[model samples]
Target: MARSEEQFKKIRDQRYEEISNAALKIFARKGFAGTKISDITSSINLSHGLLYHYFKSKEEIYVALITNVLELFSQAVEEAESNNGTPYGKLRWLTELTFKGDFDVALDRHMLLMEAMQADFLSQDTKEQIIDQYTTALKGIGRIIAEGQQTGLFRDGDEMELAAYYISLSQGITLWNAKGLYPIRVSADMVLDPLMKRG
Candidate 1:
């Protein structure tokens, strides 16, 4: 019997995600320039034609992965901004959300973002899009920090700079977690400490 349209759609979505996961694994480790279509295909035991059916080229896969990661980051920041609570509470929520996942998978996603930021070979448009996303995230976080400062719950400083520090601290911890050199579960306090107001 022939598969229904819904079944075909489900299979397509599954294959697309599989290709994405396989591509992400390679892109995270090899960087876009170093990675090849064959690398991603073989990693998931997928054929070249099948992978192409989902993505046009290796660059397309890398771009898709980066775009998806940035979108998630943007959405999280937006959520924090819209959250009805104290700025400190919002920051805590964001911090917790960041660490609330598989450490290895989070590390991979973070690594890909880091590499993409430094990848000069990428199209100017793609680079600009990344910068735009970062700017948006920083602005959202900065708004939260600004509110916290108004309430005397956060330190006084440039809110944007504080936002950068906030994001950097979280990303640093992600990289550290993957090292396995130190077995410690990072808590939200560790991330919010620098921003939190003190007597």
Candidate 2:
């Protein structure tokens, strides 16, 4: 009839996630600086004090959001590398895995970028952290592309540039064609047809 320590921890983590999710929506609607603790609190009908019990500051919450996404990105890289398959196969897997999420409807890139650009409170270190993680992710993808090239499966181009283009194309499609063809199922032919190895 009593909750165990594990149960209590689960409940606490759930509540923390609830606050973060709600705050993100509000932050999206009204830029970060324009958002207030009260906005997040009122949106979730939680007291200001209660929210602070989980997060020390709004900046912390924003950082958590960024860190959360970065973790997902890292996972994608790990999953691709860990796959005991061909380079092309791994790249395809990465494509499907990365774009499988509901990113189009989840958050707006413009809003988040604007907030980051305008937030003076965002520390330089935080910006660097983001950049570093992003570069790592890119390299993971680039390595696969390079492997594919070495095996004569992919075209002869800059590995990093090709990887970046793949990401850019997927992002562009997801951002603009929210309800349209997405993940393109990460079809290998779509990539191969254009950038495949040529004799």
Candidate 3:
């Protein structure tokens, strides 16, 4: 009985992973509005019934993808915070992670999901949840900036404002990179130097 239960759990986990991977590829290639359950099924070689068994609808899968992406980002920030580095180093590391570092390959897909959410396609509750998650993540960055100021590692300024600036800058880079206006090959360190050196 125990063995059977373990096998079932393993199969369930595997199915979920397969579905997520298929969804990532489809959503990245085609925006959320353009992706369909059939697209995911075709990518995964799964039946529509099987896909529906895992996710009630395409929107559910999108929400799950967004949640997973945010969790991965949060984990990166947490790991950077726990590292034994100077405040400036930590900030640099965080900036690099946010901008140039390798994140989940599904990030492009997640960007599409964000656009849909902003268009009011996602429910208000989900929108609020996403905003709260983003706010929490930014607050973590703000705390680091505040620490840097206290330790004389950063210039004197409003930590919240600086945090907001960095957050917006990171998002802008993503958008511009998507539009081919900015190169993804540029290091975040290169971008941060001028901004950090501002008087």
Candidate 4:
């Protein structure tokens, strides 16, 4: 039986996703310096040849993962901006959405971003691109916080600072979630506490 072009395309996309997922986990855990192409392939029980078919090199995979995550982050911010809700409500919704996933997956993604920012092997162009996306997301988040402040819903503070704090809080919670020794479960409300207005 002949596989249709659409079917082939679907398979190709799936393979790319699989490679990305495996690479993301490795890159997050070990950082670029410690991660090897074989590490990603072995983690997924894939052959080096098969993995290489999807990605040319480990650096390519790293760049792809970072680009994909930043793009998703931008999309999420855009969606929140357009969603029917107050700024504070949108922030709450986003916070809940961030944590509403497999703990390890979420943690890996946060850790990946952290490591990527500090990685020195990435080209200057790639670093600048990342900074651009990050700054855009930060500005979008700041706008939301600023809007909330105007509505008397968020506390008075620098919007950009508050937005940075919001992201840091989410990342902190993600890291803490991976610590099995802790019995604490951080909530969206807890993360948003810094921004919420009080009497």
Maximum-TM-score candidate: 1
Instruction: After the best TM-score superposition of candidate 1, give how far the Cα of residue 171 lies from its true spot, in angstroms.
Output: 0.9
Q: Could you give candidate 2's per-residue lDDT for residues 67-178 as a string of tens digits?
A: 7767777788878988999987897787776556666433454346446645678888888787788789889988988988999888889999998888777666566555
Candidate that beats the other on lDDT, 2 or 4, i.e. the better one: 4
List the pairs of residues colliding in candidate 2: none
Clashes of each: 0, 0, 0, 0
Candidate 4 residue-wise lDDT at 18? 88
In candidate 3, stretches whose alpha carbon ends up further than 4 angstroms from where it belongs are: 1-8, 99-110, 175-184, 195-199
Ranking by TM-score: 1, 4, 2, 3
lDDT of 1 at 26: 81
Whichever of 1 and 4 has more TM-score, that candidate is 1
TM-score against native, each model: 0.96, 0.85, 0.79, 0.94
- Of 1 and 2, the candidate ranking higher by TM-score: 1
Model 1 scores a C-alpha lDDT of 0.89
Candidate 1 Cα outliers beyond 4 Å, as residue runs: none
* Candidates sorted on lDDT, descending: 1, 4, 2, 3
Q: What is the alpha-carbon lDDT for the whole of candidate 3?
A: 0.74
Deviation in Å, model 3, residue 170 alpha carbon: 3.2
Query: How large is the C-alpha RMSD of every model relative to the true structure?
Result: 1.0, 3.0, 3.3, 1.4
lDDT of 3 by residue, 1-199 (tens): 3578889899999999999987877777787788989988987789999888889989899889888877876777777777788766777887776765444453574465466458467889988887787777777877887887777666678877887787667766666666655556757676555336345
lDDT of 1 by residue, 1-199 (tens): 9999999999999999988888888888888888988888888898999888888878788888989988998899999989998898899999999999888878889889888888888888889898788788889999999999999999999999999999898888888878889957888988899998889
